[model samples]
Target: MKLVWTQIKNFRSIKDSGKIYFNPNLTILAGKNESGKSNILKALECFSLDKFNKDTDFPIDYIEEEYPEVIVHYQLEEDIVIDLCDTLKINKENAHKISGVTVTRTSEFLESIEVDIFKDTLEYVIDAVGEAIKVINRELKRTFKLDINSKSSYLLSDLIEKIDSYLLTIKEFFNEEQSNKLNSIIEEVVSHLEMLNGFSDYISDKKFKATIPNFIYFSSFEDIIPDSISSNEEITPIVNRFFKVVNQNPKLLFDESNPQRRRLLSDKISAGISGDFMDYYSQDSVSLKINLDGDDLNFFVYGTDTQKPFQPRQRSQGLQWFLSFYLTLQAEMKTGSVLLIDEPGLYLHASAQEDLLGMLNNLSDKSPIVISTHSHWLMDPNRLERIRLVLKVNDQTQVENKIHKGADAYTMKPIFSAIGLGLNNDISTFGERLILVEGYSDYYYLEAMRYYFQEILGIKIKKFKIYPCLGSAQIINVLTLLVDSETEYFILLDNDKAGRQTEKKLKAECGIDENKILFTPVKSKNTSVIEDMFSQKDFSEIILDSLDTNKFDKVLVSKKFNERMHNNEITILSDETVSNFKEILDVVATPKFSHREN
Candidate 1:
């Protein structure tokens, strides 16, 4: 069975809501913080619950004293319906039955009776008499056998004929509409009750809790393991034991921790898994164990031999955050639960962050994963239908609100732009390819070049988008975005001192693979730049060659001067600002072609 729709009223930030359809396989709730995304999730959790804990406030009130209610609707398999019916004690005669046959037959009988009755007002009176005769006929049929000379039957038949004659005469006096109305009333009174056995069985069946399966969530940051174990042991036992509890029995997750019992284990377990995994511990391949002399716990991290435990708060904020979520994933797997992770990419190295995203994608096939993050590195546009945007509208606004599925990167670009989120664009639109330019000159230059290329080559290129740093000083920011996106970048910068410094900064700060960057050679001899200026120079010569000699002579101050000297701004050339060379001026004049390209 899958939850098809859910509605909430006066619940926290949600003043009112309508049906929210969910994909059974995966449903994601995403939005900037405080958009009521969490509230919707909470409502789902609340609707399916048997009881609310002390942490929860019941009957959430948003309008003065109005109580809020949440309703959840689900679609179940036929077998699940049967199980429900068996559990709810719904019988064949109960209203919970879903079949339509019995109800339809009863309706048809009533409709037929109404159609056949009194033809007019006069007929209505006659119909009453006809009804009396029918009743007498029924009595006769029940009380005695029909015989040639049964005096009692004959008397009843004579009375019925007399009534029928009066009813026919009266029918001729009344309008047809009035007669039909009267007939309908009579038919309704005579209709039998409908039997709803199927519905009863289905509705009365036992309710089963929806258990969403779980997946892993890796954090983005990486940290160095301390050289010496601080009185620590391996985390193998703790990891294995936690998974055992989750897979074996998830209910224990809800149980309050027994401080005394846990303390005894803590001396040997140090930071053993918490939350919902303690109850299902079964000896598995994963070995979770205590470390830091029972003060910490560690778990296996791929591509490494020794287990790493949680770090001290002062060590690294990102690592500390990551460890918490990593542990949560391990715990979730054991309980067959869904994972709800918020921002798993905090404080991690770029490489580590990419690795984390890869890990999560792999785990999603096994279980549903719901992550609320601002990082674009984790998004895969082709697989974006699972994404949902939670929009929070002002209560004062008299407008309808809804949740929308994110279709692709292009679809979400405007939304990301509104929130100042460059990450989403980098992931969905640019992917792993980047073009880093020094400033707006490069930005506009690249754009212009692209247009020219498309027209010249007749082949469109849109693999990578150019990112213009405000200046050479912002190269580090550009590099970080590129690295986080896990793509190589081509840094096109001016060959000036500032540009060289920019390159050095990226090299020292970023230390990414050499293949990731495509830089210029430092020496003047290596100035074989693949630039638009050189191309423009060739194009300029072609245009000068094609122009009328007389037109050029009129524009040039001295025909004997070299073509280069006339083109240079320093030399005296023409009185008019416009040039005889149309190609260059035409390109510059056209708004579409004038923009710069990196």
Candidate 2:
């Protein structure tokens, strides 16, 4: 089962969050600080919690003293519904009506079925007996001067006996064919009545609970306590729970009698933590050890650089937080669980945050993760479909699942910061007129070309800020932010299918003017990328400098350029690469800005 939507009322800052929809794999709740992003995660956490606190959780604006109700709606998968039916003893026919099925008394079962087939059969039998009694009464009154009253006790008993005998010999009352038809009708009616009764009984007797998805909520990294400190505190329960999950026996942590079990558990945990540490640091010789100091668990890491072992607290805060979070998830989380992480990359550096992002993405394959984040490195630009904008409106929290094309500057600030921070370079504050490119290499090449054109052609062009959009797909997100900033911008996309599609989408969906969009000029008929703007010889030389000369090929230069650019190395544009670059600048610099005095 998956949580398709959520609505919170009278919960903290959110009065009524309307209906916040979710993506199956990953849902990112993004907003400014104090926009109640964490509150939304907490509301979801309520589903898994055993008790609720009205005083702390309820909205203060509520005038009446009433308990707060947090209602969450879930969608059950077909397999889950089938399993539920089997568990509840609900037959296949009745299972179809599970969503609408209600308890009804045995006396009220007849009213529950609209098609009264059982009632009709009883009526048919009663009429047949009445007719036979009428004939008997007429014959008795004429021959013996005796009229039989249908309501008289003796007459009723005699008539019931005759009806019973007639029903027993029902086959004799009709031909073989008629008997078969009659029996079939009676059997069908009987089966329908039995099914109705059984369904009613099942509904009345069985208490079926909704299959609530398991929710695991993680807030700030500060809440994560190191395994070294052994105390009966808030984190002790989580540690105990994690140990039980990892070893299936919490006693192994303290049971001195079972040294073998203790050793085995320690080795397993040590190997698991060491493996994660190696993957994280990309070092083969890194070793991790888990030791029990009295009742407390301690972690010690040994790196290839240092012979001495150091505790986790001795490491950076970011590494400590990440290790704790990762280990906790590994030990505590089960398959099909829903993870709610609040500001996951809060402590990590931008690069480490990226690694955390990748880990979260991989973890999402096993369980759906809904993360509330202000970090751009955490948000996947390619998966904008999973983003939800949490905003404060009229003092109530509102979550918008749809990404607005015309999002204002304030709303787009976090995204802009995220993108800019991830690039590790601030967008040039040269001029309001922005020149957007597909990638970093494009920005570097264009800037070099602009200078070359100014020097060679003696035409001083308007200096526009060269902004790299990271990818063609991310252009719209940047544009949305730029438009809000009232920044006049022009796009230079690669002459490829993806670039063309992005250009078309920018024009149609984002309402970008067609004249503002430009494609790289290429001599060949093949689809042109940013690398095409430069001479093949110049680009190949740059590639050779970065990669092995033996690996250099005309066909592989473009791919190599991208690889080099990702490593923050851009090949400077030469004089020979000026024509295509000059052409693009000439068009963009036309009547757009005040001309520079020659």
Candidate 3:
């Protein structure tokens, strides 16, 4: 199941958050220091599989008077729904009626949080038992002028007792075969009664909890791994995670008397952590060593160049936080978990913080990540559509629907990828990996489409460094600067008159490979330009006239289109429009077509 949206009311600082939509992969809650960004994330966390405290969770003013509620909606994936139906014995045909579900975890029911599932898949099984009861009652009335009223007799045992006594009175009215047939009908009804009670017990125990993905919250990494822990000492959460990652019995490793046995376990643990931890921490080629000499298991890190082991605390604070966070994520998470990460990359420097964002993107591919951060370095300007600006109005939390500022982190450095020299670039170097669009308007459309590919569609795509060359003739001008670049090039243009004329010039002037050109496809295959790649109705409304092309307004249409794309208003687009962009991206992603060296 995919988490779609959430609404919180009277939770801490938030009085009401009006249906905040979540991106399929990632959603960032961004704001200033005390603007309640973390509080908003905490409200999401209170969709508790555990208990919720009213005093701590409810708003300060409305603590005793009001109850807080956090309601989340999920889109049921077909495969997951099928698996659930198989487990619970629900009809697959009836399951089709429910494609989405709303779950409300609220304090309204009691002091503790209560979970209510709307239009659950188990409804099919529940309703089947109800229909069976009505059918049996109808047959009884037709044959014996009797009706089984469950409301009058609440217990299944009571109903069974009443039927048993009544059957004795009617036994003389029928022959042996007729009496057996009557008993058989009642027996089938009894089976249904048992099944209904069993289902009720299943619901009371919250057995359907497997179908709903639980949120795993990690607030921060305040402590690093301990230098030494005793063999019999109570294991803290951090130490517990460390042993789990290594798949080692910490007590056995510490208590071993044989030096050789201790060395074997220690070496295996050191090598395992070094391989996994090196993937995220890039500052140094550091290796972890676990010492099992005495009752205490000690930890240390040493650079590969210099084998002198140093305590974990001796390393940079940022590296320590990175390892702590990574281990917690690996230990606490399961296959279908949703992550709630708060203010990651707080201690890291600028360059390392950027790398942390890349790691988060990789994690988002597997599970839905709702991360909160005020830091700009963690922001991706192309993914501006994913940002929900969190702030406080009249002492209550208010999350803005639109991103007006767009990557509030770039205020100091004046560095945002969307400023035209996109992705990672300065003024002089316009990034090595190039994707040249036709004009500024084409650039905006492609950038918005990249977010859709990554977050909504879950497509693995290159972090494209798109730069518009203004026109087809200007493609070579951008190519000249990236003559000896490392990555692939993508030249996007319309399938029209000027585009055909300019294609030949690209090969002659830039010495570009024919395979590098990724043309935007149009469905109609008429005299179509890049704009015609969209729906015919949308194109006529947003760009050209409904019938006549003479009333075209490029500047006005481009401005309106850009605004709508940022606000995520243009998402109700035709599948053909999305397919056109996907085809172009498919070519761009293909690395088998090698780049020509200048």
Candidate 4:
């Protein structure tokens, strides 16, 4: 089963009832900060726990303290259809029984003699023929007057009038011997006319019907722990209660009457939870070693370390989160569960983040996963369909979220293709390969170089798209996602320390071949697009080396731009030349007067 959709009513920043859809594979929630982005997940967690209230951390009121309710709608896959149907009160074959019947009876006299009074008389025939001929002849004349010219048309029209005028008289000419045959012909013609009168009613009745989804809930605790600890033996009952509700176990986890079942659990604990590199070790020290002998149940973690029993409370915050997520996933796999994880990348390393994402993706193959995060490192470009941007519009009360799924990524600044000649989307739409770049200058210079190569060398270099991110910090994540989906991405970052480090990280993380990436040569340390231009005086000479940058910088930093920047007309880097000049001054001067504090 999978969570198909969710509805929220007056929940925290959410003012009215609204629905958000979920894909079976992944559902990503994105927002700048506290736009109540995490509220929906928190609500689902609350519902899972079957404990929701105003005082809860999952705030259900933005303007005032209002209790809001959330409903999660779900559907089961084919294998679990029967179980789901039972849960939703659906019986596919048990439709409302239609047993009552409408009565309609007739005697032979009423059926035959009464209706026979209005026989196929000449008058009746004349009236029906007159109406039919008028319609057919009028249409014929309007449609094909040229084909049925004067003389030939006269015969057709005269015949029609004759048949209409003598219809009653002609009917009287027939005896009882031929009456039945004529009656049959008349009935057939009437039936044909009835059919032609209007369209079949089926068109209006044939339509698709929608099925309302089943409702379910998922709950979690900000701080989940036992309320009382009377004895070491009591720990089992509390743990059992929590696990029973959590896993939705058919039999109670704490059913002491079933010793055989308890033995199975004990056996499982003895065998241990072992993986490729680790094994679980547990000890009931408080029960077996201390006064309350047969009471305590102690759990421990064992991996790349010595043997020692540890309580769940003593584990690191990160470890607790991991184990909780792991157990939750396992339970969900058994019950066809949907998972909602908020800021899952918290305390996770870059490698671990990728592994966790993969694990989630794998589990999602069975159910659905909805994640909310602020980390760009968690974004998978190939899984762009799962990303959603949450925004608060007009006021602080309502949240507006937009889901992007197409092949394009939006940026305020202009982006160029790999060759720096064409626009970003144009290349992505047309090119077969891509070279991801860093910023605007690299994009502009590449476009100009592509033009030179095409014009002077007659080389076809427009077959590539160049994507310019502000930095290569997200390149590994982007490449990891795209490469797995069979998209070829080549990096062309600067040779600076940060850029080199980014390249190394990308290779280590994504296993991308070095040959595919086009790193700037080490010998050309001072040969960057920015540096190349700074070493020149006349714009004409500078244009010879990188014509695109020279033109863009000169035109972009003209008096018009200076006026706008000086008057505070444009805020973000109003003039490229001024920006570049600032960078140069920073590099040369001792204590540079930089606009950027960093």
Largest TM-score belongs to which candidate? 3
Best model per lDDT = 3
For candidate 1, the lDDT comes to 0.41
Summed backbone clashes in each candidate are 53, 0, 1, 18
Report lDDT per candidate.
0.41, 0.61, 0.65, 0.43
Error of 2 at 533 (Å): 27
Q: Candidate 4, which ten residues in sequence have the lowest lDDT sum?
A: 108-117
Residue runs of model 1 more than 4 Å from their true location after superposition: 50-61, 82-288, 291-315, 333-336, 342-360, 395-598
Error of 2 at 446 (Å): 25
In order of appearance, the predictions have TM-scores of 0.39, 0.54, 0.63, 0.40
Candidate 3 TM-score, C-alpha based: 0.63
Angstrom error of the Cα, residue 343, model 3: value is 0.8
Over 253-351, each residue of candidate 2 has an lDDT whose tens digit, in order, gives 565546676678788877766776557543135566777656766767777775687886776677667766776556545645788888886878878
Cα displacement (angstroms), candidate 3, residue 78, comes to 4.8
Q: Put down candidate 1 lDDT per residue, 60-172, tens digits, no spaces.
A: 33344444455544444455445544544434343223211100001011100000111122234334444533544463453322222212222223433444454454345
Give lDDT: candidate 3, residue 363: 70
Put down candidate 4 lDDT per residue, 486-508, tens digits, no spaces.
33556776767777787687778
Where model 4 places Cα greater than 4 Å from the true spot, the runs are 16-19, 45-267, 270-272, 276-293, 306-315, 394-598
Error of 3 at 162 (Å): 22
Q: Which residue segments of model 3 deviate by more than 4 Å?
A: 63-65, 75-80, 83-90, 108-199, 205-207, 334-336, 404-445, 448-532, 535-598
Error of 4 at 351 (Å): 2.4
